[model samples]
Target: MSENASATELTSQYTAQVTADLERNTKEQERVGVEIAALQEQLASLQRDHTVLVNIQQAIDAVPVPDSTAPPSGNVPVPAPRKKAAPSGRAERTRPSKKTRPSRKTAAQPAQTAGQTAGKSTGKSAGKSAGKPSAGKAEAVQTAQATLVDLVRRHLTEQSEPRSAAEIATALGQAHPERAIKTTVIRTTLEGLVAKTQAQRSKQGSSVFYTAADPSRSAATARSEEQPEPADA
Candidate 1:
């Protein structure tokens, strides 16, 4: 009786295991079916979009071009159409390709751009002859000189008197105490001003006194204006 009971328990366990495995397989199949359905739907959508694109391309290809040269009567002077190539039995694959050669007229023309180079050189020489200084160097010197002259003019206008190189250097030194002002530079600038007729130089013992010249005045008035104010009574 115990043997029969053991056999019956084993059969029941095997049947239960088979039932569980069948249920798991069915769930897997259902999941796979759902994924396949989604892929099919995506494929269908892509095919529809592709068909629409093809149709759009066909429509664009079919569009007719308007002839602007045609009058309201639709007649226009279009060029004669090229004749179709004659049908030949000499197999297209066997035909010898023609060699491309430049025309004799084009080949005979000079390649050296002599005219362009000559024009450019001539222009440069003319520019140089027109009292133009060396490009960057001359511009820089002129700019610096203008700035210095402007400063000196401002100083003289403020004081209503001409400044000696030493006096100008001293003032500059005080204004920019960190910078060194060479005596030579101040003297050169003063000489340039005198040469330009902006300032007049007079001898006073061994030292030279510089004065601003009045552009529109006679010599006597300029001399009188140069005198110091009289003492208070």
Candidate 2:
């Protein structure tokens, strides 16, 4: 009888211990999940900030630098030439000749990019325009896009991990709100730019983050082996 009682007690103790261990493991798992969620949120926020910064940097790069000699504001006087030109019978080349002209009508002002829906100079104008990107201004837009794409590529390369488009845009917007970046525009630009950059698209569950890849001579070289080689090559 005593032996039977001892066995029962031992079994009970083992069952209690197993239960305790299971509960402890569950709690630890919950904690880990919570931590992961927090980290993901933090990472997303950083990505948005990065995107905003990239857009702003692109805008800064795109905005043509005005001829300093022909200051937009005439308040600042340009220095007068010290020596008068010695006249040859041929028309003398004037130092103050208006050689440089802005390429576009709004060359004096800022230009817009594709998918940028906001005010002409404000974020509002770009939002309303469903108009396609112009063929004439394609070169200018491409130039701006390239600058922004390069900035984003560099930003990703500098980061230790992948980043979400929203996070990238938020970072860029915060860095340069004056540029008036729209989240949609940022998202679209990043997607298009990624094609050129050959950045890695990492999927954590359903969420996608872009991881910067090493830039080779061309993006084709950076492509995954799964992708087919270009026909031209």
Candidate 3:
């Protein structure tokens, strides 16, 4: 009977130890699963950031490179390079230079003076020629008589639908190749016209559009105002 009880106690202790071990293993597995989920979330975030960076890089790379040798617009002249000054020190004053200085009355002086005079005359003539083109441009502008605002009004009236400032400026440019029309100028003019009740303004998304006000309504209002109010009844 003592031997059987000792064996039964040993079996019970072994089963309890196995149960405790299984509980610890389950807890460890739960902790590992939580860590894995956290790591997966971090990995997803990193992937999203990586995609954004790649798209930005692609956009930057797709930009066109400007021509290096192309001259910029406008006839602004490039300045000449400055001449280097002679070194001022006591180290090399004794040695005579290989290049001799010419006297004021040398033949080279007369030739240089003549060349300088010719250059001055040429510069004056060029300035006069440039002035003529500007004068002609002013004359043409005066001859146009119709201001930019008038042009914009005409364009808006001609179109059945409202037009953006950029569209109106493009149309103005096409119609008048001699004029340099800017979208900003057109937008400001449209806004001014709106303030004056000459045009109606509307906005769609980020774009602003303009349309001519109804002339019939304005004419009717003018006529009503001009008519006497039945001598105040």
Candidate 4:
């Protein structure tokens, strides 16, 4: 009887796992579908812009450049040049005196540039030395940085199931609108992470998904989610 009970429990567990995976897969499909639709819309807009640009270029090409021989539309006549009297031999001999200037300014320019560079370096060093961040500020600085891979890895860790690159890009973009997150960048980062074994990649039919490096984390998350919440007192 115990053997039969164990078998039934095992079957039930498998069923639950299968169910969870199925549901996750469905959600992923829907999310990717939405991202694909958005991408298509963007592509259409870009194509329209491209068409407009091509038309403008063709129009520009069709217009011939005006030539010098052509008369002006205003019908303005060219003015004759006025003749000037030539200087006397004495005046011509007494040309403006050319004084040789000392290379003071030219020589000083390099010195001034060097001084400015030194001053800038000194100021930077002084600021870095004097205006040190407090422990909190230092931590915050480390927390908010330009490392996209770190950001993507952290994002993946928080997710229960694998996520598509488009979905990840969209989520990150919405969360950090100023950053202007892009799906191509996300996909490239994900590929690098996978190569490093810092992230896991899985495919469902034509769709690819990424998740945390740890394979078992997703299973654990699913189990936890499946667990019922405690009833109200």
Candidate 5:
């Protein structure tokens, strides 16, 4: 009787140990999954930032830096000829020749006026051009704010049927060959969209598909089209 009781006690302790280990393993898996998801989101954010920075850097690099130190092309001044001092009582009435200086102030007046005019024109043109890039940057920021999830949502919106993650990734990859859009990332992004209720998922046999969720005001067009609408009352 003691032997049977001892065996039963041993079985209970083993079962309890197995149950505890299983619960710990499940918790650990949940924690790791959450961490991985967070890491992926951070990675996607960094990648988007990197792309924007590279574009801004390239735009900045494209602008030619004005060389402030270099002298203007043809503005070198000619030195005036110096005259010797006359001796005492000598006829020192030396008339400066017409060739010596040509109507100095009158000559420079038109040139200075023209220069000011040119400066004003260039300043206006520069101001106009500078304003353009700021507008472009604003547009770029607006576009950049549309992240991978938005893109996926947009793609789904464009489609009339449900799509698998691989198909979505392939279509995006084809559209933006420069971007290395992976199926796994697309799938994860889709899952995020699903969680937000921005997208919907359906299962057909072993295959799962996704589509953009309809607005609250409207019924799902895809489902309506694929399935039949009820006869109007």
Candidate 6:
């Protein structure tokens, strides 16, 4: 009977020890799980920081380096760093004050003073009397009298075959360096002459060419037409 009691007591003590050990193991497992979670969060933060640092390094490398062989011009100027703006809620109002408008009487006084000054001044008449014929005015009068059509006609007549408008404008420019001639003006003038039957125009591909009309042939044709037909003979 005593042996049976001793065996039961030993079994109960063993069971209690096992239960205590299980409880300690459960608490240790919970602590380890929390540490693992904290480590994962730190790793994620470190990875994000590493990525940001790598991007900054790449941007710095992308900047161009100045040539070392070139001469240096004193100290390089550094731009001032911009200041950070204050929070919107904390910012102070900086609106400008309204400006006053000028009175109409003050505005009219300037005009009256200007008119009185003009009435007292007789310098304009003296300036007109002292003025002589300017060289620029004389040159302008000469250019006005010079006919561009006559010049283009002469150039076409001098050429053996048809000439392009660009060639004519270039020849005219070379002949009269003072005049600023354009190909479009020459082309318009050629078209005008073609309309008036004073010049012949031919198109070869995309180029338009001009030739002076034959005066002799035209005169002969006119004379033949003028002579009355000899009685149907």
Please give, for residues 1-233, the per-residue lDDT of candidate 2 as tens digits: 99999999999999999999999999778556544544454465567666756665565556443232332332333344456566676445554455573345444233233213222234333333322223324444343322344556666777887888888877776866655556555555555544444566777998878877666634556556458767984
The residue-by-residue lDDT of candidate 6 on 10-84, one tens digit each, is 999999999999999997785565445434544654565566556555654555543434433433333445557
Backbone clashes in model 6, listed as residue pairs? none
On lDDT, the stronger of 5 and 6 is 5
Clashes of 3: 0
Provide the global lDDT of candidate 6 against the true structure: 0.68
Candidate 3 per-residue C-alpha lDDT over 76-161 given as tens digits, one digit per residue, 9 for 90 to 100: 33344544554777437744565674344563565556656666666677577546645654554455334566677889889999
RMSD of each: 45.2, 22.9, 30.3, 20.3, 11.2, 48.1
lDDT of 4 by residue, 172-209 (tens): 88887866678986887777666556689999999999
Measured by TM-score, how close is model 3 to the native structure? 0.34
Task: Give one digit per residue, the lDDT tens place, for model 1 in 155-223.
Answer: 555656656778877887686565456555556656655544556777767887677765654455667
**lDDT comparison, 1 vs 2, better candidate:** 1
- What TM-score against the true fold does each predicted structure earn? 0.29, 0.31, 0.34, 0.34, 0.52, 0.33
Query: What value of lDDT does candidate 1 attain over all alpha carbons?
Result: 0.58
TM-score of 6: 0.33
Per-residue error for 175 in candidate 3, Å, reads 0.9
> Runs in model 2 with CA error above 4 Å?
69-233
Give the candidate number with the greatest TM-score: 5
Give the Cα error of residue 209 in candidate 3, in Å: 1.0
Total backbone clashes of model 1?
Answer: 0
Leading candidate by lDDT: 5
Worst 10 residues of 3 by lDDT: 68-77
